[model samples]
Target chain A: MVRVVLCNCPPEDANRLARQLVEERLAACVNVIPGVTSFYMWDDELCEDQEHTLLIKTTEERYPELSRRLAELHPYSVPEDIALDSARVAAAYHSWVHETLSDT
Target chain B: MVRVVLCNCPPEDANRLARQLVEERLAACVNVIPGVTSFYMWDDELCEDQEHTLLIKTTEERYPELSRRLAELHPYSVPEDIALDSARVAAAYHSWVHETLSDT
Candidate 1:
């Protein structure tokens, strides 16, 4: 089954990362979402501002490689990268993801 | 914990559903991503076209309610609503999710 990862990055850097992911074909599809307001405490100060979110589509076999690549490319000291198995998805869509990635 | 659902919808009706979800508080935050191209089979025929993706953020307590509401409001007979628990997240962010939603 294809594994899914949900990630959020600063708006300034999100686009570049998305480009890299696509250029590498680490994800069959990378959805870039702008204007996401994220609220969290950074350095003991509560902050809320616009950011970008990425929906990365890849297979479980490629997850470790993808995660490593993301970590190397990510700018944040601690980036948000959460991977979970997709329980319900169109069968056709799942097949597409598997077909899109290179053999791991 | 906040349950995450990754859903894709026909672009024409994505915004309306997003609005409904926000108004209903099914998701504390709903991101509407435009210009998504989806390829799949409908009625045994291959179809490929643009669509929109939604990143719904809500607590686990509301997953069932949100799924039910989405089904009712969704135009598609088989709407895509998949919930998965986040494996890695900032502690502060996790708390924010819990605080965002009302009890259950």
Candidate 2:
């Protein structure tokens, strides 16, 4: 199975973190999408932030490690590091993702 | 039972489709993310596209309608409308999403 992890990070740290994940083989591909405006209630106040979202493609077996490593490397005290399940995917693309990883 | 649908759309039509989904209550929230580069094999040749991705937040029960509606409104001959399972989500946020939709 494959998982697409969404990590909300500060704009400054986004590119570096994306590169790190791919370099470490934690993710087959990491797309650093910039220019996102996040609005939410925090500490009894509505706060808005300009953040970047990292779209990570990796296998289920490597998910735990990837999550942990992301938290460790991420700058946020409380990171929105959630892994959404890939209910469906193209077989060929899925295979290609696996082949790109180190231990596949 | 929330679902996150990823739709690959041309940059020009992304925002309109996102608003349509929200207006029709097919999705509670649609995040129109720009600056995506997609590469795939089409017709035995490598194809590259600069597109935007729509991250739609909706419930599992409404998924079929959402998918159908998206395809009908989409400009692509075959839109990438695979719904990724929301395996986990914050309780408060999930409830908030449901409340925003008309059918909820």
Candidate 3:
């Protein structure tokens, strides 16, 4: 099954993380989208700031390995890494992802 | 909790779905990205084709409702509506998603 993982890291760290993931072939492609603003409550205070969002494309089988790599390289104590099983896809493109990563 | 749902549907069906979700406020915003090619195996056949991907932004609390709505309107027998819990975010932007949906 094909999967898409939604990940986020500090804006400053986005490029390095993306390069590492792509270099490792954990992702066929990593689109770095900026200008994302995030807000959450933590440590008894509500904080708000800007961040970068990474849209990662890969396969289900690679998730574990990919996730492990992300944890190792990620700067946050707890980085946002969520895997989503794609519901339906065009058959060929799915195969392309499988092929691309398999070659890696 | 802020959430991002990655959804794929036929390119032809993409616009209507995006408009519906936004109008209904199930999503604060829906980004329609085209030129996506997908491949998969089904019914003993490996097929390939094009698709449009929708990146939906909303709150975790609204997932069930959004998923249900997606199922009702989606063209595919099993549409791809996968919810991913965001791991970390800037404090204020997280609150914005919460606020936007609440107002809806």
Candidate 4:
């Protein structure tokens, strides 16, 4: 029931997005990983860029809104927003995530 | 199916583990994210530590070996090895990942 969403953005936008997501209750916590080099294809051309990756943690129920808001706020026209379902989560950490998001 | 495995380790071991996993073919690529502050509970106590998070990209079929090798090489007695199943991936990137691991 937990989802960790992966998103890569420019380094300048990293902290702003992370703070907004957590503040808006769209995510319980957001971990920003800086200076990641991502290599992928865009328009049939290989592209590589330095980015800051955001690890957004939220529950299944909040994911839809989180995804929507992320798209609306993201700088890119089509940002990478991939959700990964956690196979196993530590009980305490899981509880904390739920509680933090629910304590609205 | 593609999976993104999350593992947190000390800063000193990040590049070594990332390179080892990729070189050993357990993972197609590993992104090292430095200076992650993780707040979790261990032994009924709250612990906050700075860690380097490794975003390991691999196939579901190759996960067992990756997990085993990660545990063996990690410095922590009980390391965090959480696998998240990628709900969706870009076609080109996904193909590249599969091909990279399969070429061995």
Candidate 5:
């Protein structure tokens, strides 16, 4: 099973985390997207921020450890870790992602 | 059944598409992320492009029509429409997405 863990963070933090995740093999790839204008509600008020989002690709088996490591490394007190199901990855691509994982 | 339809396009195209999707109720929300450097092989040659991605939030029921609309509006002959499952959406958020759709 494949999943893409999504999180929005400061651009500097996002870049650092993406590199670390890939280097550690917690993620096969981490696509860092900059210049995101997010408008969401926090504390009953509308808040807008400029944030970068990381789309980290990994297998289901590694998610727990990945999430743990991400929490520890994240700057925010409660960092977002939304795992969306990559329900239909191509066989070759799926195999490549698994093969890249150090723990696999 | 929440899904985030992912697609990459030119920054200007992405911005216009995001607004159109939301305004048309094909998507409850659309996040436009710019500054994406994508490297991929097409027709046996490696190609790289600076693109913007749209993360469009919608429900499963509307996906077929949304896809049809997307195909009609997208510039490319075959624009990518990767629908990743938002498997663990909050109750309020999920309901809101469904409720926002005009067809619902």
Candidate 6:
């Protein structure tokens, strides 16, 4: 099974993290979507901030490592690390992801 | 359980679709991440395009309707409608999402 991990980071850090993930074989692909407005509560106060959302693709086998590495590298002490299980994926894309991750 | 549906749209139509999804109670929140580059295969040819990725938050019960509506509203003949099952969510945020959808 494959997982799509979602994380929000500041724009400055987005590209670097995405590249590192791929280079380190922690993720097969990381799509960086820039200019996102995220709303959440911090210190019991609602806050909004501009961020870049990363769609990180990897296999379930590699998720734990990815999560740990992400936490270590992410700028935030407690980054928004959410894993979403992919119910379905295109056959070609799924194979591609598996191949990319396993190539290491 | 709450779900995060992923869909990519042209920049021009992103905000409208996001608004309509929320207005129709199909989603509790829709985070529009602009300036995304997606690579895919069409007719055995690889293609890349700029798009806006939408992180749509909704519940499991409402997924079918949301999917149907998204297909109908999306400009592409075959849109990327991938649903990711949330493995875990913050307690406060989870409650907020449930409440927002249930209020309808």
DockQ of each: 0.17, 0.17, 0.08, 0.21, 0.24, 0.25
Q: Measured with DockQ on alpha carbons, how good is candidate 3?
A: 0.08
For B1-104, candidate 2 gives per-residue lDDT tens digits of 56777888999988778767776767766666778899999999999999987777777877889988988999988999877676655444566556655443
- Tens-digit per-residue lDDT, A67-101, candidate 3: 99999999888889997775444444556567767
Residue B70 C-alpha lDDT in model 5: 91
Runs off by more than 4 Å, candidate 3: A1-104
Top candidate by lDDT: 6
TM-score of each: 0.59, 0.59, 0.55, 0.60, 0.59, 0.60
Model 5: residues >4 Å from true position, as ranges? A1-33, A38-51, A54-82, A86-104, B102-104
Candidate 1's error at A76, in angstroms? 12
Model 1, range B1-104, lDDT digits (tens) per residue?
Answer: 55777788888877677666655656665666667889999999999988787777777887888899898988789988887686544444456555555632
Q: What's each prediction's clash count?
A: 0, 0, 21, 0, 0, 0
Indicate the docking level reached by candidate 3: incorrect
Docking class of 6: acceptable
Question: Which tens-of-lDDT digit does each residue in A1-104 have in candidate 2?
Answer: 67888777889999989999888998999987888644433442334567788889988877778877887898866566557877688999989888887574
For A1-104, candidate 4 gives per-residue lDDT tens digits of 57888888989999999999999998999998878755443343434567899989998878888888887898977666668877889999999989888888
Which parts of model 4 have CA positions greater than 4 angstroms off? A1-33, A37-50, A54-82, A85-104
What's the fnat for candidate 5, on a 0 to 1 scale?
A: 0.38
Give fnat for candidates 1, 2 and onward, in order: 0.26, 0.21, 0.05, 0.33, 0.38, 0.41
Worst 10 residues of 2 chain A by lDDT: A38-47
lDDT (Cα, tens digit) per residue for candidate 3, span B1-104: 67777777888999999999888888877898876544443342334456777888878777778888887898877566656567787899888777778886
